[model samples]
Target: MPTAASSPKNEITIVGAGIVGLATAFHLLAEGHRVRLVERGGVAEGASFGNAGAFAFSDILPLASPGMLRKAPKWLIDPLGPLTIPPRYLPQITPWLVRFWRASLPDRYRASLTAQGGLMRFAATATQAMVAQADLAGHIRADGNLQLYESEAELAAAQPGWEARAREGIEFEHVRGERLAELQPGLSPRFVAGTFTPHWQTVSDPYHYALALFRAVMARGAGLVHGEVTGVEADSRGVRLRLADGQVLNAGRVVIAGGAWSRPLARSLGDFIPLETERGYNTTLPPGAFDLRRQLTFGGHGFVVTPLSTGIRVGGAVELGGLKAPPNFRRADAMLTKAARFLPGLRTEGGRQWMGFRPSLPDSLPVIGRSTASPAAFYAFGHGHLGLTQSAATGKLIADLVAGRRPPIPLEPFRPDRF
Candidate 1:
């Protein structure tokens, strides 16, 4: 059993200043809890800064599905494919890959789907409430997502997943011919079909959205600390966070939302979670880059082109390279080349390329429970690509746990000791 936060005015210290941390701080503050946000870099400076910006409430499927496995082999061969594991990292990644394979089994996949479905449902509701509460509606766009396909075979191959989404009450439309062009003009004739989800929404820009959330937290009396956290220790006295500068701050409780750089902190606290990094790549072009409409997904190719309030951002792929390796910008180049072909009028020049780490678990679910080591410590990391999408829900759930109130959803599927 975990120790209760004890009072409505509990002082909580959260590590990591990304979307997850900001959102967690927002919820805690809503309950009149005092919060101090600690970060090694600027807010939303990591993966949260450059994601596809979709709310993705409809993306309930786990990435470890059989479909992903079928695509992985082909993607692995091509260094710049939608998914790639660096040759040197293969040995280290094998164990995680084995777990991923088991997760893709029919029985396991169904279990994960049920849990993910519940989270997505709660997430959609929680995100709306958060946005409304913070009055950040100006940053949101209701423009739906259009996933493009090149051939009938490709479209046919996607039917099962669509059917699964339908079973979960997600609304979507399958369109071909002129309707495709109407949804997104200037597309190459090669794209024969698409599926549009009308409820999907996006932020004008992910980083700005997070910054808005941070400001909301601050307005409610949250403090911001900038430094690398080297260690976390807890005892009956309280939880203490040690920074690289040899500073220590004690708080009523601590929540770790440290994205891809969180594994070491968790390990030091006695939990051995198999957290890995998916090095995602992208490029942001100038504002007038092809007048991109809503986000466009080239699923078969493994990337997306999104229109942000800042610019037209292009490309995203899973590169299972570790944290230490230098980024291969050619991956960005590859996706850009493909985007130009799909959107005939896309201007590829004058773009800024970026690479960031997305922390992941083999089961494709985040850890959102108290640390098995101590009741005073909690976890809210390993969200992978869905970190931005699920941030608000994770925040609410973590707040519920700290307050000693039963979470709206079961935590069994996201327990810290599950492994």
Candidate 2:
């Protein structure tokens, strides 16, 4: 066995430069560890760049809920619907689908909900600290977010989720009738009811926010390496990363935070995770296209329209296409169509379409613990839509685990070996 002195003292190398990876680097740097970040592409170019930008802390419900299964048939039929599975991608994702179905069972769903709710409870404070540390306070808004329902029937259908949230101690204000307009004057009269969670926050510019954190990490003495990590090998001493360009990097510890691309590395570490890519789409309208005081989710249309520093961003939609498939921008166009109808007066021209992969697990829970195959390796991916919301808290947890300190929250549910 290799001794501790064989590796550099207090050094850690992290793979992936997305929000979660950058946030982890920041946290590890604060702990007096020398850190290095490796990225295949430019920073924040993945889901971090084009997400809905809402820190949906109140949305603790798992995506693979029992109700979602009931609606799957209808959604799958519509190519541009909120959720669709490409017929060609079905074979590749069938095992993940089976796991998703099992996770939707009442017992498993409750357990996931409880675990997710606990992690989200620390979102606001953790993210606020990171924002302040990274000097990104200007990029964040704490005005809350709203989920709109065009009719009372639509709101009634969402009661189960609301009840689950209530059981988890999640709070929200129910608005109906004329009160909706008072809360959001710019909203269309079609929205008769809404649920507002004041604790939900939004990033005025998600890409910039991530970049700020990345720069902060560099300024704090962490090095950033631009290369593709093809494989990772860990042992009792440390870990070695093989780059595509025939370069090898070694560190005292390694963290796999590659988001949608983490599965292969996890497998190399002897952990087989049921991680799948949820291809999500977004469209950002031209500057001043519309005015929105807070982020709004159109419940019936299953999309979110958010106010950003650059423009009004309309995003939301799930396509189960593997990583190799070309992006289907039509999904983004469909979101724009829904945004136009949700806000009748909004301008939808001069917008850019984007699509990125969201790392999703069957249970809708992130893997955030030390690797079972190697003590020097850690895992922190499979966050799906909550990556931005949970990044800071996950970073703190990873730092704690690496330093051999007890985590602030329970880690049993998020163990890498759980699957």
- C-alpha local distance difference test of each model: 0.90, 0.88
What digit string (tens of lDDT, one per residue) describes model 2 on residues 1-419?
A: 55664344346989999999999999999988888899989998888998988889899989778987877888888889999888999999999999899989889988999899999987767888888887988888888988899888888999889998888788898998666776677777778899988889898888988988888999998888999999889887678899999999888889999999999998888888889999888898987887677899886666888889888899888899989999888888888887887787889888988888999998999999988899989999999989999999999999999889998789898998777
Per-model tally of clashing residue pairs:
0, 0
Q: What is the lDDT of candidate 2?
A: 0.88
Per-residue CA lDDT of candidate 1, range 317-389, in tens? 9998888999999999999999988888788899999999999999999999999998999999999989988
Clash number for candidate 2 = 0
Report the Cα lDDT for residue 2, model 2: 55
TM-score of each: 0.97, 0.96
